[model samples]
Target: MRMFWGAAALVMVAGCQAAKPADPAVEKAWVRLPAVQGNPGAAFLTIRAGNKPLTLLSVSAPFATRTELHESMAADHGSSSGAGGHMMTMAPVKQIDVPAGETVKLAPGGKHVMLYDVAPGVQPGAKVPLTLVFADGSRMETQAITLAAGDAAPE
Candidate 1:
């Protein structure tokens, strides 16, 4: 009867609806190649948040002895006039926030993940595994390809 047709229509409509996408997280992660061993390196990535805001807790890499989230800031050299060379320094940060439905980019000369004391064996054309820990106790694993020191960022 009419009730049976109504139920069939409802089921058809439900079946036609597309499934929702998976949770958003990190994407397009890459690590800049280091000039030499035992030197610092930088990592860049974009964090896409889901319904709730995401906080980057920490970063870990196999090539580096220690890895930490860091931000670069311009230093004030006690110069009232803007006539001196700008000095930049990097400092450790507890967490980086990625607002809901937004992407936070970690790039060179800006906020980035700092890798200290990189191993000598880690060379160009190598694949470095990076684990990004979030505040929600979720972790995303990605691979960063090591490029030449003079090479540009991956497209």
Candidate 2:
């Protein structure tokens, strides 16, 4: 009986180790205020998926009533405004996939989160609370620094 119990305990420990997932991290989170008052805002950040694939479901913030995952893609090459007749367009994305052991950046003029009806207090130098929801039903709560219209992102 003692030998059977030991064997079962060893198997349980091994199974626990095998079931562990990689650690995920969010860094350099910052919010960019709108250029004009009462307009919408945006947020940028870097997501690191360590040794496991991840899907970013949505972003929510206390300052904005509506937040969404969005992407900027090139469209309508017929227009000739230079740059090889390429025009930028914003599209709503349901989710953003981050591969295993990779880093995805949400930067200016690229993939980012759109914030609507932002509050007045979410100004430069302010720390706004942000919640990142993942497809695995995991939520990460972090604070994002606010940047002015012309301010640069964090290093």
lDDT of 2 at 65: 89
lDDT of 2 by residue, 1-155 (tens): 99999999999999998778768899889999999878889999989897778899999898898999999987876676766777788999999999997889998779999999899867699999889999999887888999998887677
Best by TM-score: 2
Tens digits of per-residue lDDT, candidate 1, 31-136, equal: 7767775568888888888767889899988788888899998887756655675777788999999987778999877899988887777777788889998889
Q: Estimated TM-score per prediction? A: 0.78, 0.78
| Model 2: lDDT to the true structure | 0.89
Runs off by more than 4 Å, candidate 1: 1-22, 76-84
Kindly report which residue pairs in candidate 1 clash with one another.
Answer: none
Q: After superposition, how far is residue 45 of candidate 1 from its true place, in Å?
A: 1.0
